[model samples]
Target: MNATDPLLTVEDLNVRFPTRQGVIEAVRGTSFSVGRERVGIVGESGSGKSMTGRAILRLVRPPGEVSARRIDFMGEDLLSLSEREMRRIRGHRISMVMQDPKFSLNPVIRVGEQISEAYRLHTRASRRAARQKTLEMLEAVQIRDPERVYQTFPHEVSGGMGQRIMIAMMLIPDPDLLIADEPTSALDVTVQMRVLAILDKLVQERGMGLIFISHDLNLVSSFCDRVIIMYGGRIVETCRAAELDKAEHPYTRGLLAALPRLDQPQARLDVLERDPAWLKEQSVVAHV
Candidate 1:
């Protein structure tokens, strides 16, 4: 279904939100791409990390305008596509796993129905077949007792179950590229690792590219192949996951310092120092 191709390439993208107060440039000429591998986008709150992901999906709402000199996916310019065309591509070839499952899920609808609806949007399947696949997806994500979980509503399930259901829905279509915008942010620490594991298995087994956007440096360092650290709406550093320990950029080094270590016996964690250079903002490097 993925077509064994380079999935997406975004170049010189700019996103801005117009408010009565002022115009906030959420993404400042950002550029990146995803092959059939895992890439992570990391930044603090209001650093424009999430905005970059949303821009790629063209999910920015009204009052927020997304303009990119070029945004290509599978040799197609996404910015040039009609909303109808984007709708067809969304959830079929490309899917997004939002941060919170409850907000994304329909409270009135059963979880199975919600996922089946996703399947229906892309496939002309009977209710029976879609239902079957829905349950199969739950099981595939390692959720126990698929039948019981399938019929459950958003409120009926725990937070962890809800996140798992979100993963199931996103993966049901076997999307070529998945933009996970802080996918496990809502889950507890224990559940977070489990969900990350599920994602890793899916990416490895399905051969799909993943754009993991999060503020958790440690998690991204371990979960992704390459890390993109954004600051003030721009990419500050790019490095291999393993090389995160040796990130070159000053902003990146500060971010690494900001993480509280387990071994250090200290009364309190030290806040990170921000460089004036990071505040200036600059271009991101694409080594691969």
Candidate 2:
């Protein structure tokens, strides 16, 4: 792909769910473009970050609705594709690593077999070739004993190991874009660093676009090339990662203030005061 070409372009995206209480707008008119670079979506719970990722894959189930003026991927309209076509693209071209590995992985299958299945489904590889590829993927994710981990079941492995296996499975097909929804949130700090390093290496080496959805402000600022701050089902602010500390929007500022700082230690961090008007305000996109 050309450097100027966008890998994915989402415009006027909206997600809604009907409930007896009321209709909940999970995401509202969100627009963004991602090239072969890391884009971070940061926000608290119920900010619709995860929903946006799922919508790209058309994963939102019934009772939930996803509408977009255009959800284009590599010049093709994703919203227009049939379910079968979308499935062909989902893992082979665009993959997602969900937050919890326990729920994502198949417990009945062996780790290596599951990974090999993903490869076989996307390619014309034989079972032997797929198994070999799966082993390589396990090593790529820094799995110490790929041979041993290959035979182990999901429940038999540690949380960190299971998470790594999930990543290896997602990347086995060498997707063009990877939407990682809080992939590191469940791991300890040390394991989180390891997982991030593996993701960073793969993204850089393969030149793949990444949508990293997370609530960790500091992690996003340091790890992503650009950041999108979501609030009340909309994007409130967007800026270069380096300039995150200098964010201007009140919601972004409030989020930054809430982060505990070692340099400016506080007995208690200030709670974010939500403004109803923010939901109506347009997204402020600041150039670094």
Candidate 3:
């Protein structure tokens, strides 16, 4: 692929589930692109932020259908690839860091071993080499003692440490794209900033593209180069992070106005006023 091309380009993506109620559309006609830069997808819960990420990776399970006009990654069509071909693309080319490491991590395995195994799986390195690389990655994520953490089980580490370990595992393969789904939602403010710093440094140094999904608008606006706002299963607006405050869409404005601010105190936080029309409106294409 040309260096100027986007690392991933998704067009008219949709995810649907066959439920007892009816066919529920989790994501509706969302279109976006990721270059070697950070792109934030923000919305309230069930607004399709997470579904969009899962669809890009083809992780949506059976009975839950995913269809797109094109899901081009590095000039290849992801939607057209077979299951075997897609497996090679998953961790080797693209990786996802799920929300809540407690559920994502293996309870029976040592944290260090898991990370080492990930590296070994992709590189087919010797145990000694994988171990060395794993330790280096742990330290790179700012773990205090890689030796101790490596020997300990997943339950032994704090939430922040677990998150770092997850990041280390996902990044070990040096994938072209990283999809982080609320990777810091469970951490405190101090720890959250630290994890964000680690991610920021690694992405810049490695020249990898990032898709950060979260419900925190302020966090997205501050950290990402560009922001995509979703509402009712569709992208309502897309803008440069610096220009988020100038977004004209009512859904976007409602979301912004609803946030609590220390500088501008009010009697109570504003409730986001929802419009039925937002569900029927066309999704705004992202500017990569």
Candidate 4:
């Protein structure tokens, strides 16, 4: 890769959870990156897409251990950073939009306060300055009434606004990278599109890198610049967004086949054909 190729890079990233039963590897030897590009990681429920995001941030807990030979971000070694140093880099330099806005946002605190707090943590800004920046961030996400919405608690706002508020809080710090893990999955279809648009716009305006993690292959195909199709805790294929139609992997093709369409009323959609070959390949890699 070129020196300017990637803002975030991972090589041989492995995450494991040691249970009484055995070691459950969530992400096994996964390698990928994001430059000024919007890279999407797509897979089924247990494919480790979210785990990969957490690994990048070093958010994996005690039982869930993250180890990598090279997990470099902005040319710095992420795996070698201390807890205190990682804290400084986590939200201040790189932010995350978690799966559910309700869970991510504080229930009791005013939304504005939470976003302002993030800004204050990153910069030596007074509460007033942070509040100003927070409101502006909210407005940028297309919130109609920034003042009223600022005062509203997380429960008081609708799902769409809550997710938007989450976006505001994450972007308030103007981070170099943003890991949005199923950020808009809880919202309605219309709202989901809007939220994605907001993210796309903000990323473009800031020239920041984004890692959008999700299970929605179709959504990733259209929205992201590049797609990383992962299965069984490893990347199965990587392709450009426009070239998704010609993806060769059995898993990728299976995902595309499973999507519902409105144009044609097919009596029975051809569910994907699973091949034993892909599983065999995984086994070989695992044993290596």
Scored by lDDT, the top model is 2
Flag regions of model 1 displaced more than 4 Å.
1-5, 265-286
Q: How many residue pairs clash in each candidate?
A: 0, 0, 0, 0
Ranking of predictions according to TM-score: 2, 3, 1, 4
**lDDT, candidate 3, 1-288, per-residue tens:** 554569998999999999999998888888888899999999989999999998998999999999999999997899999999998899889999988955698999999999999998889999999999999999999999899999999889899998999999999999999999999997899999999999999999999999999999989999999999998788888999998888877777777887887888753435545553544464454354
Tell me the lDDT of model 4 at 260: 80
The parts of candidate 4 lying over 4 Å away from their true place are 1-4, 263-288
Task: Give model 2's clash tally.
Answer: 0
Model 2, poorest ten-residue lDDT window? Answer: 267-276
lDDT of 4 by residue, 5-64 (tens): 789889999999999999988888888778887889999899899999988999998978
**What CA RMSD would you report for each candidate?**
2.4, 1.6, 1.9, 3.6
Off by over 4 Å in 2: 267-277
lDDT of each: 0.85, 0.90, 0.89, 0.84
Rank ordering of all candidates by lDDT, starting from the highest = 2, 3, 1, 4
lDDT of 2 at 78: 98
Error of 3 at 257 (Å): 0.9
* Candidate 1 per-residue C-alpha lDDT over 1-288 given as tens digits, one digit per residue, 9 for 90 to 100: 254456888888889988889998888877777889899999889999988888888999988999988889888899999999999888888988887865789899999999999998799789999999999999988899999988889999888888889889999998988999898887789999899999999999988999999999889998899999888788877778987887766667777776777786533334546643455554446464
Assess candidate 2 and give its lDDT. 0.90
Worst 10 residues of 1 by lDDT: 267-276
Per-residue alpha-carbon lDDT of model 2 for 1-288, expressed as tens digits? 797579999999999999999999999888999999999999999999999999999999998999999999998999999999999999889999998965788889998999999999989799999989999999999999899999998989988888889999999999999999999987899998988998999999999999999999889999999999998889888899988888887778878887887788663445545553554464588853
lDDT of 2 at 25: 92
